[model samples]
Target: MQHSTSRWTMLAGSAAVAAAMFAFPSSAALAANATLPANDHVLRVCADPNYLPYSNRAGQGFENKVAALVAKAMGRKLEYTWASYRGHGGYSNFLAENLDARKCDVVMNLPYGDHEESYTKPYYTSSYVFITRKDTHYHIRSMNSVSMHSIKIGFESDTTPETAIKLLDLINNAVAFHVASNPQASPRELLQAVQDGKVGVMITWEPAIGDFLKDYPDLQVARVPSEEYGPGLPTVGYTYGMSMGVRKGDTALKHALDKVIAREQPEITATLAQYDVKLLPNPRHVNFPNQ
Candidate 1:
């Protein structure tokens, strides 16, 4: 999430290939208990097999459950085409290999707006949070907080949070974490640093924080607020909308997904809750371009 590469990068190979002639406006339009290659009865999902709290080969991630919910709502079978979203080069092959190659109809958990693919309206919103040990003497609600100046901070370098820290003259107090060192283990290592006293506080995106929270009972989390921004920081940008991606012009699937997302929002929220996700308000509205 902290990479310099735009997370909303374009599809490497843009193909307008449509599936069967049929297109459904919503899940109801599809027949129940249908199978693939039979009038598009299956929801082919493209996902990373090991990114937990999100997805994995074992299908234990919330995104997996969300995918099933989508398929069930559409009355179609769920079939997965596993692919790593990241690699030695970092999130480079995701769209080229999967979405562009038509490995799946939709790719889940995209940050909404401005992408090579036509993303469905956001399904949920989350934020970057400030995590600290429970025994810490104070809270860090933003970069300007009093505690932030004295504490050693840990964050993936080159992100806005790092920028904010630098502008605030706290660079000397910062500790950098490399998420790409090990996609599966990086977040854990960051959290572990906070847990083990390597850093007094850590700021991280919400999605990566939940899965490791159970192991760090002493950690306390606070959602960084939008108000945390100043001259250099336009907004704390703690909040962001997350959506699903489909072919660039696949409005058929796009609208259908938007409906399922709205209809199944309750279930989706519950899924995230099961992982102890740090829920924040905002992102119910998407910042899409002119309609």
Candidate 2:
């Protein structure tokens, strides 16, 4: 449960190793979609085939719906370059396979300000949350509420929640389960642990909790309050802004996407609401890049 390794490193290994190991799809295959009729405008999106609440091959995730909305607003056809980064050793080579190799023009969801690629202005913000059965009545809204010595909490190993638990000295009483240990360790299995009484509570990302709540009304989630980083400054713990990704130096495409995001903001919110995604409030008087 207590491992001294960063989650990002545990998942992606080293950049050099990832580049050397992943076989980039051929240029021909990447450009195949470009040959469509000139009149047919298409937005090629790179996405995972099995990741849920984000994307899947069947286009069921919220990101898929957002992509479709963007395409429609721009009067284009939606196409996907289904890439399985999880299969390549549970790490994502998104920038390489999706953008560098020209497999897709854009990635639907990526952490905003990611240096790996140019990101459009963030459309939404999210954070980690605590999930527990409604009957437990364990009102754990923050790390302060956790009884380090008595209450047992569960979280995906090598995630932000585990890090927070360790920082708060709760690792000994926490159950850290590695999702990569089993490729199928999705939200369903994680929540099932709490439902089966194997774990008292589970700390996971909010998006997954939102999706699961629809089917399991017996479960409830508590949003983690923003942590004070310094005097007069507080930031949401494990929270991040999410945005669409395009290749570096693709300024025109980025600007066009920015316009689309600004114009279709309402539609995007509605789409995310349909999936029960918990949205963070936008900061006031904020300025985004290229704005």
Candidate 3:
């Protein structure tokens, strides 16, 4: 799933194009005795002001927590550059407005392999999950599960999960939700459909799953396995790495952020766990420290 708050939209390529178009500073320029903002002592973070479980204006999201931790560790205060992401062309210019414009120094959460900017070592991995209430008795572990074709699945349109469902011939039995249909629509809407018995299951990104499951503990989550992928389902990976994003030329800042990530690995895990974030295998060989 594409990170940076919402997973429903595909903006990775657009962001990369914006980065190139903006003519952001090169690595050489960034490495030439580059330093943090003079005398500010602030960690400027770029984030979506309304996207939950990732960031919000109130600083309640897991990314907000991690950013705070990083700032505290570096003896700097936390500052925010609130950029809104409304999916597609609505507010998809975050790369140009925030990073390239120097609105903030770092984006706290971005897809690890995203080419839009320089990335620190991956901090965590997550994926889309199948969500169903416990009372439904619908055990969906993989695409091969017998219940796959029988249940009514709800998912956001134009997502990896939706593509997989189509490949499995489940689209006819699926309810497709669209972000553009209503600017306020969210994973909550899909989860509510399941709760109201409108759909038997909902497949969505893990962060939203973790957030909504807090209020509906009876809901079961099944992580989509990588081995279940087949022909015509090229976009449906079960897991993806996530990392912090910095401007392309900011190698010095990138290295410093990486060091902070390694030193604060335990705190970062704890912060994500506090928000019920479902963490996948640590690609950096870092284990979740003792709580």
How do the predictions measure up, each by TM-score?
Answer: 0.81, 0.79, 0.81
Which residues of candidate 1, in runs, are more than 4 Å off?
1-39, 184-186, 228-233, 281-291
lDDT scores in order: 0.68, 0.67, 0.68
> Would you list the clashing residue pairs of candidate 3?
none
lDDT of 2 by residue, 235-263 (tens): 32456566888878878778989999999
Model 3 per-residue lDDT tens digits across residues 229-281: 56553333556667888888888788988999999998898888887888876
lDDT of 1 at 237: 49
TM-score for candidate 3, please give it.
0.81
Model 3 RMSD vs true structure? 6.0
Candidate 2 deviant stretches above 4 angstroms:
1-40, 89-91, 180-182, 228-236, 283-291
